[model samples]
Target chain A: METAFTPFTSFGGGLAIGLGAVLLMLGLGRIFGATGIMSGAVFITSRAELSWRLALIAGMVLAPVTLFFVTGQMPVLNVPVSPTMIVIGGVIVGLGASLGSGCTSGHGVCGLSRLSVRSLVAVPTFMVTAAITVFIIRHVFGA
Target chain B: MKLFYALITGLVFGIGISLSGMMDPAKVLNFFDLAGTWDPSLAFVMGGALIVTFVGYRLVWRRDAPLFEARFRIPTGTAIDRNLVGGSALFGIGWGIAGFCPGAAIPALGTGRWEVALFLLAVTAGFYLRRLLAPMQTARAAS
Candidate 1:
């Protein structure tokens, strides 16, 4: 369960993510909120909206393929939780994000960058809860 | 043009996520587990992203509008209401239960794992459920 600090790689990745957000704002005048984008894709409220959402999602799905070409293999990610837990957690996240109108990418990243007061409040609220949840799951339930 | 630009933007974001180790649910979970073998790497991802996006969005905002869009679609709401707080709190619980945020989980779908697929499906159902319950909330507000 021990993990080494990954400052260098994490920073490098963060920079790339920042650049991507910059591109969206600069080019499309839009925020790069993952949940919002995906929901918009799911609902497909407008034809104009569909193009950008689908395009963005396609690009997201293609990332591993891009990495495969670069590294000659797929990147395997660890879920670290039970399948039922993943589904339950995922549903809660989905519902919560919709109700809150943003998630980490939306409120934590892009929203904070813009200095939105709502995001400033939101980022901490979620961080605390997530930490508490982890505490309960790991220590109390010992999952 | 908007679609193309969005696609490329998504590409960069997805690649950044893959590179940053955000895809690893354990890595993310450890960040929350302060009493355990905590990994502080995820902070850098948010920090690195904020540095660029903070400056980048500002620079972009100086422009009259984005290249592809006629206007910025920035969120107008600023109130720190119950919905914002409560929804985010719920999301935090879900995130703690599973380290996979929507941003991380969506791209990991490329792994073609049934777990990821099911998790996402559950998330979609949650969103649909929320939409179904929205009228109740609206009616309450109207009353």
Candidate 2:
């Protein structure tokens, strides 16, 4: 398989993500964890906090279309998993995120930035496991 | 005001994820394939984000309060428990299988893909499942 390495775009996009996270922290006093925000929007009893959560998710959903207008091209997302596999993956991710209390953005980006010890442990654990899974699936299973 | 800020932050985050090609599962999976055809661009993405957020957090923490809220809602957990490790391990496997973390998955929904939709549905179900299981665990502990 050919490798696709685009450092410029990746770095630029990363900066934007960091900026977005910082903005959320400084402006709203909230951690920019997608799962947390999404779950809050879905399950929270407080109606007052719902609007911002909905807005954030709506913005995320519309971003691709907004980019389409700016760049005249849609993002290419090639998910190489079957429908069943995708559903199973999603369930595990959702459950794990809830139990772990954060996802990539929460634990990987924000938590690391804050120098949290638990995130420090969680990030490496997940990254290593992710690598192992990929190795098994692609190399051993040859899927 | 808070809603506006959240919307803007989320939009920027979505665009960043799209531009960084993090939304592409193949690229994400390639990053995990270190022994095979490894792409190190994602590392740069994380690095760039981490640096900005590291600095951003330090500066933001200097302020007494957020611009729009009374207090910052940072995580206070400090334990390295089974839930953290086990949940992270499960999340990593799911991420490796699908290459779609919560951040990327939310934005991918804009593409209107059936697989994305299915995965999201499963994610919601998983969230509810976890919610339902929490009380059972509490009951068992109490007993």
Candidate 3:
């Protein structure tokens, strides 16, 4: 499939992201952490908050799906890993996001912007672990 | 009311990222294809983020306190020691290996992209490692 991904398009995307992140922080006094959002949807039993959580997630899932329909341009990615590896990987990330108390957006973007020491620590660790894992998978294990 | 605002704003943010092309992993992957063709998309995204953040931080600082909170919780410690350097190095390595950082990876998963799942798993594992070692690191510091 032909793709027209360009830097100009990304600038528009970045603007939205920056604005949204700032609004969330100022409006709700909460951080934008995807792992935390997922965890909240699953673990939070309060009915009052459930719909909002689900909506936030639905928005995330739906936005791209909708875009794919409108533009006929869903991102094309090639994955060489088996389903078992996928599950293992998801579990690892879920745990890491939880332990870190934020994902990349929370720490890397929002937290880093705030100069949070904890984020400074967590973001780098996340980056290094990802690199080493990728190396091992592609080179040594050939996964 | 607060929750309502959060949901609406969050959805808008998610969609903005998608439409702007920041959430599309394939576009990001091109940047990692440094040997074949230099993709400048990453720079745009970073530039956009920095621009927004530069202004947003200043605005936030002048407020005397966060809009929804009693105070802005800046990190107290001023020292740039081991934790700072080590974590940052690790994060850069992870980003180098997996083109997807934490925030982007979460959205990518919605597209049924399994590589993101793998990346997430590593992120989760990293989180746990930090948690498990936190106590020991603190103890070692005391001794």
**Best by the DockQ measure:** 1
Worst 10 residues of 2 chain B by lDDT: B111-120
Q: Write one digit per residue (lDDT tens) for candidate 3, span A1-143.
A: 12365677678767767776776556544556666666666567797547656766655655556668778877445443455555455445554455446656667667777777777777667655655555554456643
**For candidate 3, lDDT tens digit of each residue in B58-101?**
67667666565566644355455565555545554445444555
Residue-level error in angstroms, candidate 1, position B67: 1.2
Which of 1 and 2 is the better model by DockQ? 1
* Candidate DockQ scores, in order: 0.81, 0.80, 0.31
Candidate 1 residue-wise lDDT, B15-126, digit = tens: 8888788878889999999988799999999999999999999999999989998988888789999879988998899999878888877777776767778778877887
Give the alpha-carbon lDDT of every model: 0.87, 0.87, 0.59
Q: Which residue pairs in candidate 1 collide? A: none
Regions more than 4 Å wrong, model 1: none
Question: Model 2, range A1-143, lDDT digits (tens) per residue?
Answer: 55578999999989988888898899888878888887887798787788888888888888889899999988888877888888888888888888888889999999999999989999998999999999999999999
Q: Over the full model, what C-alpha lDDT does candidate 1 score relative to the true structure?
A: 0.87
Cα shift from native, residue A76, model 2 (Å): 1.7
lDDT of 2 at B52: 88
Query: Per-residue CA lDDT of candidate 1, range A26-139, in tens?
Result: 988889898899899899889988898899888877887898899887765777789889888989999988888889999999999888999998889999999999999999
Q: What TM-score is obtained for chain B in each of the predicted models?
A: 0.93, 0.92, 0.77
Per-prediction backbone clash count: 0, 0, 17
